[model samples]
Target: MASTVADVAKMIDHSLLRPELTNEDVRAGCDLAARYAVASVCVKPCDVALAATRLDGTGVSTGTVIGFPHGSSSARIKAAEARTAVSDGARELDMVLNIGRLRGGDDEAVLDDIRAVVEAAPGTVVKVIFENAYLSDAEKIRACRLSEQAGVAYVKTSTGFAPGGATLADIRLMRANVSERVKVKAAGGVRTLDVLLEMSAAGAARFGATATAAILDDLSGRLARTGVATVRGDLSTDRRMGPDR
Candidate 1:
């Protein structure tokens, strides 16, 4: 089925995780996310409370990262971070997997690391970031399997601090390997509506985008040209225009 503007908007996790971002930047990002009705505003750990406050009644969930750009933190520390973030009104948590441990073939340690956070956050949605830029294909698949076994909500592609970002091949591989219960999130490099749609077709159910405004603006323009209503299943223009038109 063709995805409408709302469909695309709901897939975005508006990223507010840049280290240099100030409180003002986070607030502006939250406003933008609310204005566009994005799925969530992914901010830094410290900004979760403020984001939640600003996003109250906005229907946009708040999210933050754990073990952030580097996944070298001990499992205990990551678990603590998750617990704190969840208590502060963060409904979603994006945590980086331990790349070094995984590379060292310590799958049990890696699984334990992920499980610790999941245990801490109980019902909170958790997206485990693979930071695929540093992992081999085999390692990536192993990470996905471990994440599924750990019962995480999603397996994400990149942290956007890596040398490379989410790629089509990686998305396809992750999608094919994981079970249906596990979703795929493509972060980094999802800067435009075209790329977002392409990733969606490749099996990315969610995207972490710093360019949420620009991409949604482009989608709005396209929908306007096609005269398609933003509401799902309206189908008023389904016959008048093709899905991509």
Candidate 2:
């Protein structure tokens, strides 16, 4: 589990990928990320340059999504998108692998699809979102294996647009399946501090969250109240959240 405020702060990739968000919203989101000193702002593709510029010197990186909610785009298009995003100052790319192909048992196609993006952005952090809501356990395991084979940096749980999101079981499964080099990221429904701490303990190293301020604020409050310099979830730290508030 994260031990300090900064440890939890840095684990979040502040999300600005909502479809209806305007440029102003993206700018504000980037500003928030910078103020919080979070890991990065995962903005829309069009906002990559703007985020990069706004977040410049803030130590927060700029990231964008590819193939997004649905991973149906052709390899060529996804690769093109990756190259364009990188050129526009995106240092991280969260890409959805071709869900249909993976479900269809087309391993080679899946690998090629992922490789296209990874190779396109040479040094950028490439995270593969499985959209696990649509896949069975077998498919999820297969995706974990293929993602490892494709040499992606992180294997992510959801795109936050799916019917279901990250669960502890999936986090554990992913962590167990992938080698130690590949980290697990949990997105969707991780809007609270307790949930984030639970997922972190389960195995996730990163999170994609739109509720950045709330989560961090809760952590800061907990630290202040307990007078603890650091915290561990498994140590039975005060459960700020209960069945009833």
Using TM-score as the measure, which candidate wins? 2
Which candidate number has the best lDDT? 2
What is the C-alpha lDDT profile of model 2 across 42-108, one tens digit per residue?
9999899999999999999999999987999999999999999999999999999999999999999
Candidate 1 local lDDT, 10-34, one digit each (tens): 9999999888999999999999999
Q: Which stretches of candidate 2 lie over 4 Å from their true place?
A: 233-237, 240-245
Between which residue pairs do clashes occur in model 1?
A: none
Cα-lDDT of candidate 1: 0.91
Every model's Cα RMSD, please?
3.3, 1.7
